[model samples]
Target: MGAAEWMQARSPEQSLTARIVRWYSFLSATLVGG
Candidate 1:
């Protein structure tokens, strides 16, 4: 899927709190891995 469509699809799958937690964890892992 395209970036815009993927983001649109994901937005409603989780609450704001859940999304934030997921994004934070992803960023942390990326930084650590890099």
Candidate 2:
């Protein structure tokens, strides 16, 4: 399954954790790539 489908299968706690990690990754990329 694709990412959206995969994420939908996760529990709410897992979803929240994934969201936090996604934000962290975005920030890190911006900081390092800027």
Candidate 3:
């Protein structure tokens, strides 16, 4: 399956870790950017 399909296949609970990692990266980027 493609990325979109894979993402759609994932449940929110299963994707929580991914979401946290993404959020962490986003926060770190903002801090570093600023």
Clashes of each: 0, 0, 0
What lDDT does model 2 reach?
0.73
Q: If scored against the real structure, what TM-score would every candidate get?
A: 0.58, 0.53, 0.54
Clashing pairs in 3: none
The whole-model lDDT of each prediction reads 0.69, 0.73, 0.67
- The local lDDT score (0 to 100) that residue 28 gets in candidate 1 is 100
Q: On residues 1-34, what C-alpha lDDT tens digit does candidate 3 reach at each position?
A: 4643454467556576676676688889999999
Pairwise TM-score winner, candidates 2 and 3:
3
**Clash count, candidate 3:** 0
Clashing pairs in 1: none
lDDT of the structure predicted as candidate 3? 0.67
How far out, in Å, is residue 32 in model 1? 0.4
lDDT (Cα, 0-100) at 34 in candidate 3: 100
Candidate 3 vs. true structure, TM-score: 0.54
Model 3 lDDT, residue 11, Cα: 51
Error of 3 at 14 (Å): 4.1
